[model samples]
Target: MDHEKVNILLVDDQPAKLLAYEVILKDLGENLVIASSGREALEVLLKTEIAVILVDVCMPELDGFELAAMIREHPRFQKTAMIFISAIQVSDIDRLRGYEMGAVDYVPVPVVPEVLRAKIKVFAELYRKTRELERLNQELEDRVRARTAELENSTAKLRESEQRRSMAIAAGKMGSWDWDWISGDWMWDEGQYRIFGVNPESFEVNPANVQALLHPDDVDQLRKAIAEFNKGARAYETEFRIIRPDGEVRWCVGTAAATVDDSSRVVRVSGVTVDITERKRAEERQNLLAREVDHRAKNALALAQSIVRLTRADEVKAYVNAVEGRINALARVHTILSLSSWQGAELSKLIDEELAPYSLGDQIVLAGPEVQLLPATAQTLALALHELFTNSAKYGALSTRSGRLTIGWQVEDQLLTLSWEESGGPLVMTPKSRGFGTRSLLASVESQLGGQAQFDWRAEGLLCRLQVPLTRKTATTTATGKFEDASSAELQRASG
Candidate 1:
């Protein structure tokens, strides 16, 4: 938002007062829209975007209080700050009336130019910030909408595969078969025959044939599990591939339970077989996707860190350190995500990781209700905190060993409000121009996290506050994208 684009409406019936207000506020570099009457002020407001309104309390018609009440009636000016200027002696009731009319402050005339400018400057800055946040939020929402559409299309394309899996489940248990231990006779249902690709009437099932159907690698394991069941340990369950009559192999799980006679002697064992090829395939596909996502994320981080290193050499080593440190802050989020098997990371853990090096035991205080973040939020917040920490370390409270920092957060209405404050260090100055880090920090909160941020550069130190939407991240990603070092993160990549 350009300074000159934000209009400050100066409303008064007297032309001299209007000119004087203009002269006093011209240096603020904002558009000063002067109106000689309340009607003219309304016209300008309708045609232009006004940030703050300075109105005289004693206008003849549509007076200051009345005009303010009218402005308040309009939704567009609901949040606009109102200031009243009056030369007459005012009573408590008069002041209360001005406030009730939505006046932020009332100035008894012979107003101090500095105080008036200071007040206007604050509102002007606020206007610019609010506009910027709206722009960023719109942009973020657009991206989210686009991404959601892409995901929906992708899911639609996979519908056929999912349907096949559903069919497999609905087809019922693999098949039923029964065995008589003493009689050495076996019976197989038609479902079992279809699974083995054999004609039910022509096929004869026996212990020897059942044994022959087992995959050689799984034969020993099945025998042990079933032997334990025979000794009354538990029901027997095993999954293995079996060669059909036509020499086609199929994956199936077999579960068996023995029936005992009145004398407590085992007479028959009934079992069921279910095909699990589709399920196993799905698991493999999922695992592959996990590996891909982890690979791409780490690779992106590495590329980012490399760019930071190449930004400067010895001449601007501090810049490199600052950038690299922030990248590491991002890496730490990835590290936490890895430790949790790619589930998610905790809020306090992210702050601790970023401030760990500079905290020096008790110099920093951390407090917040426990919260979990998905990978995207974790990464964005980690970087934001890194920038604040970098500034404090360079010029704020953390510059000295004795200075202190406090970090806290809470959630309300799906928004996570966090605060960072520092004390007992060198004096802080608010920068007139923001650099890449500063802009990037704002973007991390407003754009990436879909939240708002405010900074107070007090003489003692910097007090930074941010509100990010409390969102949950998913641990799933497509099996595509670039990789950094596959071998180094192999364990994490394959965690799924």
Candidate 2:
């Protein structure tokens, strides 16, 4: 649409000056209204809407500043652009006065034709844009009033349909997609873009880029499904993997069907894709947990069987005590493993549990660096400690009121070395023969855990040292080879 011309008024007593401004600004394609006096300019303004007013400062009666003050007093011309032209030098005070009277700019004569034309052109264009904006705003308000009734009538049904679509998308983590094979058009909804971790503004959806997002192994699987669909398969569901822009791999299940023409030709394909990553991971965890449960059950049963078969006692009471003690030790370690989700058990906690029953006041000191032992290692260590504690209660440190015992361990170069020392007990002596308890301790530390054990017999007390190697799967240590002070340890306080 052609824009209507806005009027630019030039006011001056000299006809030649007014003519010159008209000649210069005529190329701007705006209507130039020339007036000989300020009174004539006011008359023109009342008749026509003037975008810009150019006035000579030295005019008779109504000078440029007076004319400006008069124009600004009228509300219709308050925002009009006014420029004052002067043949004389303007002082700072006069320029300030002109500004206060609503002058937009001042052009000193002889004025540059380009500068005059540029300033007028800017104001004229601004006026046109302002008028155009006002027109558009009015039109929009009219359209809104006309559609109010129609929108109100359809609001409920539209809201219901939207609610259903939103619920389905949220519950299934699903998104819809369409592809026009004939026109090579690919369309995806917001949910569809989100499933693939795509920024809709940045991603250009096309066949090649879509295929690129697929896992290389699953690309052939999807291709095979498409091939089957072409050969008279109406619908197909396939699970595939998509690698997102962030390099995260997610599983998705897509169910699609083709729109077949009368000649049995496929022209379009539409489908919904659901993210199945979490479901796939859950299934994997379930399978792994089942296998782990079976493996651990058999190991526990076999360990229990070994303790039963090897347990020996001359009397029924002793036999029952030995079997029960060993079995309870095994159960305690198993409890730790279960609490840790079978990941491992902490060394301090295992020792604390085994020694908890035989604790005395400040006589038994236990210290160890933080260490995590594998399930099997923890169980074996627990049994060995039970045997040692049983012997102490019967014949060693715990057997005497003045006896003192200290247990400390440290880790270095993936190896854990534990020291068990006893003192202030009845005089110690070497055993004439290795009993069932001694044999079982050796078998547990050495054979089961792939570690070493040494026993030292002294006149004062019995001392034992155990060295166990840690592997990636077997154990881990957080301490940097520093053993905690025996007095400061919480378990030490409990044992004491």
Candidate 3:
């Protein structure tokens, strides 16, 4: 078979057998290394990159199983395929044991060279394909990077060109006017008359007449901008109020650049003026809307919190405490969202923060792989955790200093199981009444998270378990909105 050459390690107790195996594999056009013993095999592995290993299982000192176990322990050799060769007939149990020792296949002694060669060739082909795929992927990534750089450069140049075009259009549509202190005459552009809402044909061009059209409130600013321009101290650019003959007030952006003659005397100050009334009004409206939105969001948050407090008021005083605690938990979730710009809350962080208030001297034990929760899932989980913590603090494990709470979670396939186990608390019994916290926890988890909660109030302590579907859409949407805009004052004080 025409294939990329690969290295193979052949280990045997007898030199003759090793040589024989080497000769058989020589026709395969692979680099074959002969190891007289398992120890020699390990030494060869350290010095060379051996893709596959063929070992005699019944070695005198360290057997093939022992060598395979050692190889499995080494991180570098963990994925290397091992095939065991033994003269003795291998039993079903022995084959199973060999597999447990990380053996890929077992070949009985008096090995058929053709069968061994074929198996080795198959693995070699797989390794070659894997390497080729990796190389192709790397090359594609490089090309993508180069293309991205070129696109980014082009985008930057395009943006720069657009800015220049905008500047040119602004210059062509607007023109500036200036007056020299020594010269009695003033220069005015046609565009300047348009900017000031006066027709050059109808009005006399003079300094006094220009000052007459300016609003009283903008007179000082106009004087200052002009003074700065005349002194060549700064660019004369400002937005000022101008009143038209019809008594309508408008905003205009004025920019001036000065020119001096050979005598070092200011000759002309030229610039552009553009009406900015609409832009200014839009900005004002945006500010008003932003403030209104902030105020309303805060009010909504406060109302939700109040509702939570009022609904759970009738439960034992402790229930009121629980409701307040849950509200705070909700606030914390919002806080995380605010910090993350409402992206999403980390599941591990949420759990840790919720249990912190009730964690008496590190008695609460939490074990779980880190996972992210969508906003709704986070909200639901926060409420559920708050209820659990509150119940524990009032009548369950958290009530006692010596009590311990074990919280853990696991994801199996599409299902997620979050378990809360309690120990060393006063004997627990099912409550006679299903309290508000209990109902809310069930409703939030089932309705909001689309998950089920199992309650087990046993003699030892309360154990609550949750099983939920890890749907992709729910995760993405919740993740996006979970903590978004959470920092707005409205969200901070929100009741629900």
Worst lDDT run of 10 residues, candidate 2, spans 483-492
lDDT of each: 0.78, 0.85, 0.76
**Per-residue accuracy of model 1 over 1-496 as CA lDDT, tens digit each:** 3444678999999999999999999989888998999999989988898999999999887899999999999998888898999999999999999899999998888988999999999988888889889999999999999999999988986896766645564486357778886797888776777777777777678756766877777778667965875677537887888787678777888888888878767788888888777887898889988876866567656536443643333457776676678667767887998898767789899877876786478788888899887666776677678778877788888889879999989988877899989999987878997655566667556654567889888988788899888753312333675333421132122222
Candidate ordering by TM-score (highest first): 2, 1, 3
Cα lDDT tens digits for candidate 2, 1-496:
4679998899999989988988888888888889999999999989998899999999889988999999999999999999999999999999999999999999999989999999988888888899899889889888887688568767867988888897889777899999896897999998899999999999999988999999999999778877887798888898999999999999999999999999998888899999999999999999889867876776677667766777779999999988999889989999999999988899999988988887687889988889998776787678788888889888998898899989999999988899999999999999998877787677556654568889998888989999987663332223774222111121112222
**Model 3, runs deviating above 4 Å:** 1-306, 313-320, 472-496
What's the lDDT of the predicted structure labeled candidate 3?
Answer: 0.76
- For candidate 3, give the lDDT of residue 36: 87
Candidate RMSDs in Å, in order, are 45.0, 17.3, 37.4
Please count the clashing residue pairs in each candidate, in the order shown.
Answer: 3, 1, 15
Rank order by lDDT, top first?
A: 2, 1, 3
For TM-score, the strongest prediction is 2
Shift of residue 221 alpha carbon in model 2, Å: 2.9
- Model 1: residues >4 Å from true position, as ranges? 1-274, 278-282, 285-295, 302-316, 472-496
Per-residue C-alpha lDDT of model 3 across residues 436-478, encoded as one tens digit per residue? 6677677656654567999998899888899877663332223
State the RMSD for candidate 1. 45.0
